[model samples]
Structure formats: C-alpha cells, structure tokens
Target: MRVLLVAYGSRGDVEPMVGFAVQLRALGAEVQMCAPPDFAELLEGVGIPLAPIGQPVRPVVKGVVTGTAPMPAEGLPQRAAALVATTYDAVAAVAEGFDAVVATGLLPAAAGARSVAEKLGILYSFVAYFPTYLPSPHHPPFERPGRPFPPEVTDNRALWELDFETMNVLFGTGLNTHRASIGLPPVDDFRGYVLTGRPWLATDPALSPWPEPADIDVVQTGAWFRPDERPLPADLVAFLEGGPVPVYVGFGSIPVRDSADVARAAIEAVRAHGRRVIVSGGWADLDLIDDQGDCLAVGEVNHHVLFRRVAAVVHHGGAGTTTTAARAGAPQVVVPQMADQPYWAGRVADLGIGAAHDGPTPTFESLVAALETALAPETAARAAALSGMVRTDGATAAAKLLFDAVLTAEPQQ
Candidate 1:
C-alpha cells in the first residue's frame, strides 16, 4: 500500500505525521509527505519522501510573534483561500496511486487534502493531537483569530455551534470554490466535513483523555511519536554531569518577543532556586545570560535523553513537549502562548505532574513560583509514576489501523 501524509504548519504539526509515516513504512507500505518546505531538512533526516507544499513557515511565524504581521481579520480570508488552492494542487499532483491520504495540521490544508481523497474515492482520515479540537460538551472550542465566543454564552454545546458557524464564515467560501473546481460538491458544515464523523484522536488517554458521553465516536489513539534514538552531544553531556540537574527551558517553534529578556528571567528564576539552567534556542533564539558555566544554550537536541536528566522542564506547553517531558519522568512548568497550549498546561497541572504558569510571558516571580512547585519532590514522584503509563506504541497502533482499513477496502480478485 502507498500512503500520502499531508500536514502543514510548524514543527509541532508536522513531526507527529512523520512519526506515523515511519511506522507505515515499517509495515511495508510506501509513504510520502506533503508539508511546508521549512521541514525539508527534518524529513530528509528521517528519509521520508517530501512533496513540499505552501510557503516556508519560519518567517511568517516570526512576523506574527513579533507583532509585525497584519491582524487576523485583515489577511486571514485571502491567505486561507490561497492555502487551500496550494494544498489541493500539491496533494493532487502526487496523491495518485496512493491507497490512502491521512491529513493533520491547519484546517485549510486538511480540507484540501480531504477533498482530493473524496475525488479519488480513497480512504482519508483526520487525526487531532488534542481533544479540544473535537466537539464535546466537556470543553469549549478553541478561539479562532478575529472570532471570539460571545461573553454571555456559557454552555459548551452553544459555543460549539458558534464555532462551527465561524469556521464556515472564515473558510467555507475558499473550500467550496476549490471543491467545485474539482467536481466535488460544496461543504455546508465546513468544520464537520473536515473532521468527519469518526475522526481519530492521537493523544495519550492518561495525559489528554476524551471526555465520556460526548457527541462524536472518537477513536482515541495514544499519542504518536517516534522514539528518539540520537545520543546526547558531548558538550551537553558535560553540562548534565557538571552539577545538580538543571531546569530545561525551551519554546520549540512558538516564537516570543524579546527572547533575551525571557532568557534572563528564566535564568534568574532557576538560579533563585539554586539550580542550573539549560536553554534551548528554538525559533525564539533564546541565549545564555552570560559567560556562566551553570547555564547552557543549545539547539535541536534529543528531548528523550535530556528531559530525563533535567531537574524540571519549563516550556511553552506545546503538546509534543508536554508528552516528551511526561514520558521522561521530568516535572514541568508550562507557560502557554497560544492555541491549545493552555489546555495542555492545564492537563499537566491537573495530572499532578507539573505547574501551569498563569500566562505566556513569564516574569521572574512567576517562573520562581511555578518552578518551586515543579521542583517539589512530590511533583517529581508523580511525574515518574506517570511516565510508566504513557504508551510508546501509538504510531505503530495507528499504522496498523490504516493498513487494515486499506486492505479491507481493496476489491477481492
């Protein structure tokens, strides 16, 4: 069988799909990817064939983080239309002869790929990394740019109704335009069409559970990730062995303004607790505070190895990072920036594995307080206990499911 995995957005969005692709290949299926060009290097490293789609995401992300881009209301509709066209063109060009197309990432891109799958009469599945993306009475929908739920609305069901309408307003036109061009019908319920009735939820049930008595029949697959096999760098090894384990801080692909100030605050907070610091210079470009041996700034290292050696993980509360830290038995302090991050932060605190900082920009005091809680012996004990419960076979599980679905759909000779 041949599979085309389509994902677009930042590393957080693309990496999980790559993990699933690896598992599919392991099952003797040919796999390819359609994603942003920014991740070409990462895909190449893993040996997955890449059919690059959309623009390089780094500059766009930096612009948004630095407040240099147009507001969502000003440019979103145009950009959404263009992305739909681009994604459809890219996927349609290379999706032929593939048995299935699995899509996860930005809704527009997913919609485009799903449309292609519809035209070809092949299997298409949409997988969400968090439960909030799926409609349920348990939680409200994620706020879209330029669209916020009315203050008077307190019920979850009502909020979801509004969310579906908002999705139509923002993306329905562009999506329908492309669908019509491809001889497909217009999608009235745009969000429902993309998510499908039986969408897959690829999250650890222990970390992010699907609330019961919900609307949809969700297939809750455990979180999908390839186990990191890279050895730690020699210099990082030296840092880990240099002293008591240090607090590990990183924002991954989420950019922040004034990263230097953020770095200084984090260092001060960690030092106040009498611990060393390891800073990851992600897209934020965070650097070490000074010529101090107690602190180290690194780029792109194995979290699987590093998290196990950390005193605590302080990060932007991305789903992938949260799961990594949880799996490594490291306590966490989640400082959420935007879009489902706050949800992950809440899950960390609720699980008793970490502390959830109140907001995105962490002050010296906030970091100190959160770190104090995260560094507690009780928190570490809980984190270690939770590590054993996190499943390591989510990607393999998803791959087998996809394989069976394809085989069952094939016409018998």
Candidate 2:
C-alpha cells in the first residue's frame, strides 16, 4: 500500500505525522510525508520518504528566519507558492501510484487528497493537529472571539489565519475564467475548500466537546504516541538531582523578543518559592548568569520523558508539549504568546492542571502561591487522575482508526 501524509508546522506538528508515517510503513505501506522542503533531512532521517514543499520552514529559528514579523497571523500566499512547487508536484508525481491520501492540518495536500481520491477512486483521510474543521470543541475555543462561529459561517478566528481573499480570486474568478483547464468548483471556504480527510482522529473523546462529532467522519485521537528515547541529558540529570524539585520552564519554539525578561521573572518566582528551575530554552534565547544555583538550561529534550521528573512545567502551551506535562501528572504554568496557545493555557487552568501567566505583568507572589498549590496533596492527586485518563491509547487508537477506515474504503484490495 502506498500512502501520502500531508502536514506542516513546527517540529511538534511535523514530528507526529513522521511517526505516523513510520507506523504506516511498518504495516507495509510506502509512506511519503509532504511537509516543508527544509524538513527533508529529518523526515528522510526517520525513514519516511519526503514529498518536499517549496516554502521555507517558517524560520522558526529567529533573526535567521522570517523577514516579516514572525507572527502566527499568516496567509495562504506566504506559503502557497511553495506548496504549489513542492507539495503539489510531489502529489502530482505520485497521484497515479498512491492508494490513500492522509492529510494533516491546514496543508494544501487536503486539496491534493481530494484530487487523488477522485482520480483513483481511492480513500482520502484527514487528521487534525488541533480542531481545524470539527464542530464545537470540548475544550475552550482557541480563538473564540465571537461565541464560537458556526461551521456554516466562515472567517472565524481560524479562517482569518488563511488567505481567503486570494483564494476567492483563484477558485471564483480564476476557475470560472478557465473552466476547461480543470473541472474545479468554486471553493466553499478557503480553509475547508480542500478535500477533507476523515474528521479528527483524536485518541481521547473527553477533551473534544463537539456534539455528535460533526456530520463528516470523525475519530478522536487524544494524546499521540510517545516515541522511545535514551536517558535524559547529563545536564538535565545533574540539574534534576541537585535541585529542590525545580520548575520546568520552556516555550517549545516561541520567540519572545525579551527572552531575558521572561527568564528573569521565572527565576525570581522560583527563588521566591525556593525551588530550582529547569529552562528548556526552546527557540527563544536567554543569556546565562553565574549566580543562579537552582537554574539549568537544556534544549530539544522530549517533554514526555522529562516532565516526569519535574515538580511543575512552565511553557507557552503548545498542545503536544502541554499534554506531555498534563499526562505526566505535573502541574503547568502556561505563558501563551498567540494562536491556540492561550486556549490551551486557559484549559489547563480550568481543568485544575495548571495556571496561565500574563507576560510582563506576572504577579510573582500569586504565581508562586499557585505553584505551591499545584504541588499540594489534593491537587497532586487530581492531576494524577487526569493523567491516567489522558493516557488514552493515542497512537494505537489512531492507527486502528486509520486502518479501519482504509479497510472500509478499499476492502484491502
């Protein structure tokens, strides 16, 4: 079986699909992952074939990357040209050979998925990074500025993140202008205009609050599979052992221009509470100081493995990273910058799993108190219970759901 996995985003986003592709390969499926072209090495390194994309991988690294202000509010054009060059070509090249198309969130490949499915009369499936097109979510809306817009209405906070205006030009005027070029209809909405995969394959249903799982085929895969790895880094090991149960601090790949300010606040709070600090220095740069005894800096370590040893985890609240701590039964301090981050931060607090930190205006005393509360007897017990519940068969459930869909669609050849 040949399968195409289409997805894009930071390491956290692309990494999951890579894992999924590997699993599909183990099942005797030839897996080609369509992600940013720059991601070629990592994807191929993991043994998943690359369907390279044209766009630069969102310069998540800093001054070396994005020319414009590196905000999450990006349009389709910023990446569309690259998608056409890389993802489109990759799909077009293999549209004849692939048996199934599996698309991950917000990628042009969803359109490719539909095109291929129609061409070959094969299966087209979609997996979500967060809730892209599902109905009302169980968790708080990531960008619910207006009472969670209905699916019928487009241009919600999420849709604005895409290039709707240009999309209108292409699907409306352009398609109408050249009807004979390809049989394409005017898109319904820029985002959902693409051929959709099956609905969300989230592992845990408790987190998804959408009633009836939308009309489209939907499966929930809560937490994804945690990859196996070696022991913790030597620095992390020594830091954890020497510290008085440090607070784990890191914002995966967020770039706060004032890294020192955030670090200083975290350090002050840690000292106030008399706890050591482990900063994960994600994509942000924080300079080192000599006086801090309880503070350690490490990067690119697996949160799933590391959060287990920490007293509490502080981060920018990416879904994958937060879940790692959430499932580890550790409390969280979420310092969200933008996008779905604030939503997850709020969810953590509401679920009694963590607290949200307003950047620059942190109430150091109160936050320290919350940190203590997170470690309290009853709070710890509740967090443990939530962790157990979240240990929903992430990868296994997702794989089973995908395989089941494939069998139902194709009857195994």
Candidate 3:
C-alpha cells in the first residue's frame, strides 16, 4: 500500500498533493512525497515520508513568470525545460520502491515520473488541477491570454490541437533528449506524451465543469482541500474583529519584480472602498511599510480560517487559491500574472462569483474596480451558493481511485 506522489512548483502546486497524501494515509496506505527541497520541512511536519527530488526550481520558474532575470534565448520555457532536465535523473531514482506513482501535472515532475513508472512497469497516474493538460474544446491552455475564440473555433478543437503542437515545438528538443536518456523513443504525439490512461482531474466539478463525453480516462474529482483547518492566531483574530471585514490579498508563491509596488497598489485599491486589508507576503517576498489603521500586512496565515473572516479575496488566481476562496464562500478579485492564472481569473467572472482583471500587472485603478465589483452583494451570494456545492473530500475520492488502480495493476500474490 505504499505510494509515491511526485509534485513540484510553489506552495500552490505542492500543498494539494500533500493533502492527497494525507488522505491515502488515512486509507491505510504508506505515502512518500517526492518534491523540491523547499517543502522538506513542510512534508516532514505533516508526517509524510519525504523522498526529495529536484532542485529549487521555484525561483527560476518565478523568473520566467515575472521577467525578473536574464534567461536563454527561448525565454521562460527554455529555462523551465533546462530545470526539468536537471531533475529527471533524481526523479527517476527515487520513484523506486513505490506501489503507485501519482504525478502532479507540472511539466518537469510529471514527465520524469511517467518515464520511471513506464520503465519499471509500475502503476502510474497523473493529477491535473487545472484544465491545461486536457485538449478539449471547452477551454484553451493556460498560457494563452484569453479565450477570444467563438464557439465554432473552440468547438473545432483547433486551438487545443495547436497548443499541443506548439508545446512539442517549444520543448521537444529537450524532451527528446531526456527520452533518449531514459531509453524511450521520441514522442510522436505531444498530447499523449506525459498523460496516462487514468488521470485525476483535481478540481471541483462545480467550479471547473467536467467536459461531457471526455476523450480520455479522466476522473473529475473535486478540488483536493486540506482535511484539517489550523487554528487562527490571536492577533489575527483581534485584527479581524477590530474593524470592518478586510479584503484578503495574496499572490501565493508567484514572484513579482517589485512586490512592494503590488502590495501598495492592493492596499490603496481596497482602501479606496473604505475596506481594511490583510495581505499575505507569500513567496513574492512582499515587504510592506506600516499597516497604518486600515491594513495588516504580514507573512502567511492559514487560509482555511482567514478567508472565512475576510470581506473579499484578491489574489493571483492560482488553482489552489481559487478553490480555497470558493470553498470559503469569499468573493474573489483575480489579477492573473501568468500561466494558468488568467484561465482561473476568467472562470471566476464566467461563474458570476467574482471579477477578473486582465494583464500580468494590473494598474491601481483597475484593481480598485475589480475589488469593488467582487464585493458586490450579488457576487457574494453567488460565491456562497457555489461554495455550498463544492465537494471538499477530493483527497478521499482520489485515494480510492489510486488504490483501485494499484489493485488492478498488481500481479496475483
């Protein structure tokens, strides 16, 4: 009953897998998490056995997202490809001694884990938190700015096909190199290169509706939420009670060139509406000046408890944050920066639960308007309504499926 969960990226990407591992353990399975060194302590604290793989690629990935550093000519994708290449050997080495390999859909980690599982003949599965991995007419890939296509265009699947082809064109050289190292043939179809027959869609059906008559063996489980809620800090509790309900602001672990500017903009935008603010300095390294009377800027706090007390949530629209806000029934202001963020932002607006501001870096006035719109009573009601429909036991459902897959794959004793 031992399993290996391979995940990478920042807290948003890693935390959900930890929650998934916890559920597997509750079902009487031994779970070992393969992740970056940044999460070593967090995994250990949760009592999950750690199988550290991959270097700290978070900074490099952040650089790609924020344009903060000088990269090779291929820009961010090349740097990401290089980072994944460096970790492939490490990922393959640690994947041994596990009954099943459940890989999160980070390009680097998933590709490496899939390669090892195939070579070893072990049961393999994948987790796609967002819709990026699926080539469906319902949505385009996350990196694309917006879904400007008409239904005819989207339904034709032209964009989906193009995205797959483009990925291969962009990263195929490095991917082919790794495939050769692993003694596997070069991929003929980029869409199927990193996918397995059984892949778990780790998002709530209510939020990201499952496409009907799916082409792949995809499981539309609800979002993998942490099973337990941490206690709120006394000072935070006092702050929440002291004044008007504050807007919760954070970008999770995504980096920005100048976080101070972003934070200042967030504070001012919310303050324009006479609302207090609680800002999370998540991996953005946001260093704020004094909170003054209307703002409380600090390091991370437990979102499960904090989001419930907030008037509205303003964030970068990561899959993890989007789901957390939905579960807490907090109206959201999504200011997407890069990758799948814009997709989630658009989704919030489509659902009528919140507002989405375009551009990687939104202006102060745009943020102010988005936040104001998000706090509208109708939007709050819509968010609350959706929250009630969101299933929170995604970990348990996913664990059951993985266990079944393991049983199905294992030879007779």
Best by lDDT: 1
User: Residue 153 in candidate 3 has what lDDT?
Assistant: 52
Q: Give the per-residue lDDT digits (tens) of candidate 1, residues 235-323.
A: 99998998998999999998988889999999999999999999999988899889988999899999988999998999998889999
Worst 10 residues of 3 by lDDT: 142-151
Comparison by TM-score, 1 against 2, better one? 1
TM-score of each: 0.98, 0.79, 0.91
Candidate 2 per-residue lDDT over residues 1-413, each given as its tens digit: 77777776566667777667656766667777777676676776677777665565546445423234543434434444334334545666766777777776544445544554555667776666555345333322333222334466463434443334435433334322322234544444544435343455543444433355444455666656546575888878887887477888777756665677767776777777778788777676654444657778786676777888887887777777777777788888787765667666767777877677654234467567657666666666766778877754566666666677777774211
lDDT of each: 0.90, 0.61, 0.77
**Candidate 3 wrong stretches, greater than 4 Å:** 73-85, 142-156, 410-413
Candidate 3 matches the true fold with a TM-score of 0.91
User: Once superposed on the true structure, which residue ranges of model 1 sit more than 4 Å away at CA?
Assistant: 410-413
* Model 1: worst 10 consecutive residues (lDDT sum): 404-413
List ranges where model 2 is wrong by over 4 Å. 60-86, 94-96, 107-109, 116-121, 137-185, 189-197, 207-217, 286-291, 359-373, 410-413
Model 1 steric clash total: 0
Q: Cα deviation in Å at residue 304, candidate 1?
A: 0.6
Scanning candidate 2 in windows of ten residues, the lowest lDDT window is 137-146
Give candidate 3's whole-model lDDT. 0.77
What is the Cα-based lDDT of residue 396 in candidate 2?
Answer: 60
